[model samples]
Target: MTNEFVLEAITREFPESVLLHSEPYGFLTLEVKKQDIKKIIHYLQDSSLEINFLTDICGIHYPEFQEKELGVIYHLHNMMTNFRIRLKVFMPRENAEVDSLTELYAGANWMERETFDFYGIKFKGHPDLRVILNDPEMGYHPMLKEYKLEDGTRTDKDDKMFGR
Candidate 1:
């Protein structure tokens, strides 16, 4: 029902799986082990918590964090109470793969595909994990911080006007 209650229940269920918990912007946010995300999600959905709605899913890339080079963010909502929660899982770039939520929420398919397209974080066990927005031949994740926001050879763009 409340953030504290939900967090307690989760912690009680899988204490080791939870890494961190926060209430940013007045919503429950939890960072858990990427490997245990599917189990946690399954509990949240089927347990009394009943976080049934998968609002959104996205990815993030932090090249500077050696072990946490890539991350996936999942938003779940309880329609009955309008309560929301965010779950995050991070992994290294070399092993940037996590269990798919498609089995729990069908809507996770496109979201997972888009995340894979942008961040190259593979969602293992997804039915059809492929590039949903980017060209397959691109062969690189575009959302990673390693890519430059502006090309050095771009003379056509005015940096002063854009506050760059």
Candidate 2:
């Protein structure tokens, strides 16, 4: 359906969570509060739209940004209408916790795992939360802005030498 209709439905069902609505690229993008993500996602899945297809879920980290140090972006699509929507939840660096959508969307399993692997944002109730790319010995998140090279050294050498 139309972006306005989808946004109206979201606002009606989740008055507290709908922070803002944006129509970028002619798609509905709903910015939601992190604390109310679970409820909002459930509402979207259960609505008449039935946007049960979760195309992707990714995380972004910004240490210098004041509003939110981290964010998790969810991309969902409606198979019946070919409409798409994006849901984003901003979170702080410390105590970053958001409800896992894996229960509602089984495809979220790998996406959430990848987000946790890169941004260190914990997905509560995730069945298998583990490192997807980095090794177990790596302590710092390479994606965050706070990440620093060891000893402040600069070189063109491969990172494998520093224990990649």
lDDT of 2 by residue, 1-164 (tens): 88988888888887878887898888788889998988887877887889888899999876677578899999989898998999999878887778998899888999998889888999999999999889968986677766454555656654566544
Clash pairs detected, candidate 1: none
TM-score of each: 0.92, 0.87
Which candidate leads in TM-score? 1
Worst 10 residues of 2 by lDDT: 145-154
Report, for every candidate in turn, its global Cα lDDT versus the true structure: 0.91, 0.85
| Poorest 10 consecutive residues by lDDT, candidate 1 | 155-164
Model 1 lDDT vs. the true structure? 0.91
Tens-digit per-residue lDDT, 98-159, candidate 1: 99999999999999999999988899999999887888998987877665567669887654
Misplaced by over 4 Å in model 2 are 148-164
- Model 2 accuracy (lDDT, Cα): 0.85
